[model samples]
Target: MEGKNSQLQQRKDDALPRGTGNLCQWYVDQAENATLRDVEGNSWIDFAGGIAVLNTGHRHPRIVQAITDQLAKFTHTAFQVTPYESYVALAERINKRVPIAGKAKTAFFTTGAEAVENAVKVARAATRRHGIITFGNAFHGRTFMTMAMTGKVAPYKRDFGPMPASVFHARYPNGVTGISTDDALASLHDIFTQDIAPQDVAAIVLEPVQGEGGFHIAPPDFLQRLRALADQHGILLIADEVQSGFARTGKLFAMEHFAVKPDLITMAKSLAGGMPLSAVSGRAEIMDAPGPGGLGGTYAGNPLSIAAAHAVLDVIDEEQLCERALQLGAQLTELLHSARTTYAAITDVRALGSMVAVEFADAQTATQLQQQAMQRGLLLLTCGPQGNVIRFLYPLTIPDAQFRQALDILGSLLNQPRS
Candidate 1:
């Protein structure tokens, strides 16, 4: 007799492509803040937070009600066609909130990739240049243009022939990997000298704190220098906040931690509290460079997602999630540091608020820890070029008791001998 999970796994294997990988084999039945229940009634602590898409947590009440209310009125009128008030209103809110100099404007999209690709378009239009520069290990998106911008090669760019041209990668400062800030700046200069001249580059895009490539925080000085370089070369600076936005990093956006401002910012994932909504917010002048009809999609600003995003903003403010993220992050960081004494394989532990990650000596050790944690009903996600980094994306809204319990599970697992 096959169990429910086994039966569903078999069906999934038959129906889904091999490329659509799943971290957990069990099918989810229901989910709440920081927890997921499988079809077999087994519950797991959700540390992955749906790949940083659930910063407000699963099915937040306010977000749910907002989506439901919008569903009552209408679903999609297509902003490019009918143009709803909610769409403009959401854009206005994001424009007001995003970190950009002078006046800012925001345009909505359905995915982070769409926002990123459109940002590139805006940059090119504004600067009248074609080339884009991104840092190594950054994960922009899977779309053709974004794939070209993305730093990682393996599975993301694998088997996909001929990425769009005019995109280049620079070395991102990673202390663990022994790449210093000077090395990164030198690499960028080398790119300008060897591949594309600074005048030909339209934008330099990067994650304030990298997500998929590894949880490496871009140093403050590095960002400042990049800002200076962009100004000197007339290149636009873009911060991809897809995985670091919505109070996950103790700030609404990771760029807030830096003193220098970017010309544009790309955001998604937690913007709608689990609903699919992405936006590109930037300087009003730069954004307006793209003439009418140059940007937009059939489902650009879905009404339900707009409503949920509005609710998400309210929830973040009312709940004081930013401060809570700092508190929880400090706790988790302390716990990981304590575990370091016992676990020799623990290499590095770095964090910016709750966006935390632990690196192991090898990919096998990281995988072993993730599997052992999963067996104990705790979900974890791994990243990095070597697949040796375990990132913690737990919701800031998680209850204290549940968060502590998850930490306990991790501590116990760390105490056990390596598999």
Candidate 2:
């Protein structure tokens, strides 16, 4: 009686956990650079980019070829056992590319969350301290430790209590939310004063651009100040570039925009062109703090994913995706501002390269806008504590004509009043 997707949705509701949030009702049968098609042959412009995980687009030819070649060679030997060259090569490439200073080293992992957890392990081992300081509104990961590090509670941290201890949270500086750099610094100072002393802290972790925290861009000075603080107290600084890496923010890494460099950088999301791979690149000696057999996973740096990552790197450079991100960012920002003239409820439009988000006056309007867009074959995603922000994560490889079409749909939606 109904469409295939509608039937599947019913099954999904019956089988899948309620905890698993499904933003799109239709199940995607296929995806291209910046669009998705359902099993029923309905097409939708993909603005979510698989939750900022497809900057290189869905199955780039280069990535596909790389994976194919690797598949012919061998699938898994486990890096710790019969190690492969591709894994080593990928690590070398990441070490060179990341913004860490002085003989950086890299270790691979299977997911962004693993990279983060390992980064903390390396920090704690290097500093010989167990205390970690994160920020409010930050979304590090979903694991027990990361859940503790994460600031939001409702969806991610709800009923997942008894999180790891000694993980403190300070404020993440967001100009849109009125949390100034000074205010954030004050919060950090308070953490040092009230919770854990600076000397006992292992690392201060933060996102270059808060991805799920409403796409808030951290102030330039805020990171620089954290660098200084870390140095003063002998604490490592870790930039969680999981969502903002691989040219998502114009630079190869978002930290490059800042004057200072973090001690370690965690990269995932678009690292392997849709393949599952993540890495932690950092100072050599610090990275070496973990003893033999101290870190690693069987699936970490699978040859296929490593090969795909190499291809993703090549695609970014050759395709000039960094520059493309900048160009797309300009267009998106301009469109949002223009729409703001018509819809004052569109309070803010934040952009850092192609990573853009439009914040509405309230959560209801934002959710309604996302539904409105989806009904017109444009997929959208909302984030923020109150769910009042719609983040744009279209692929950098999106065709120009398609990009404009998605923009037009958004512009039209902005003109409509909340009924």
Q: Pick the candidate with the highest lDDT.
A: 1
How many clashes would you count in candidate 1? 0
What TM-score should be assigned to candidate 2?
0.98
lDDT (tens digit, per residue) of candidate 1 on 1-419:
88999999999999999999988899999999999999999999999999999988999999999999999999998888888899889888888889898999999999999999999999999999999999999999999999999998998999999999999999999999899889999999999999999999999999999999889999999999999999998999999999999999999999999899999999999999888889999999999999999999988889999999999999999999999999999999998998888898999999999999999999999998899999999999999999999999998899999999999999998875442
* TM-score per candidate: 0.99, 0.98
The Cα local distance difference test for each model comes to 0.94, 0.91
In candidate 2, what are the lDDT values of residues 1-419, reduced to their tens digit? Answer: 89898999999999989888688888889887887999999999988888999998997889999999999999998899999888888888888888988999999999998999999999999999999999988999998988888889978888875889999999988777688999999999999999998889999999989988989998888888888988999999999999999999999999999889999999998999888999999999999999998989999988889999999999999999999999999999999988887797888899999989999889999988899899998989899988999999999999999999999999898876543
lDDT of 2: 0.91
Clashes of each: 0, 0
What is the number of residue pairs that collide in model 2?
A: 0
| Pairs that clash in candidate 1 | none
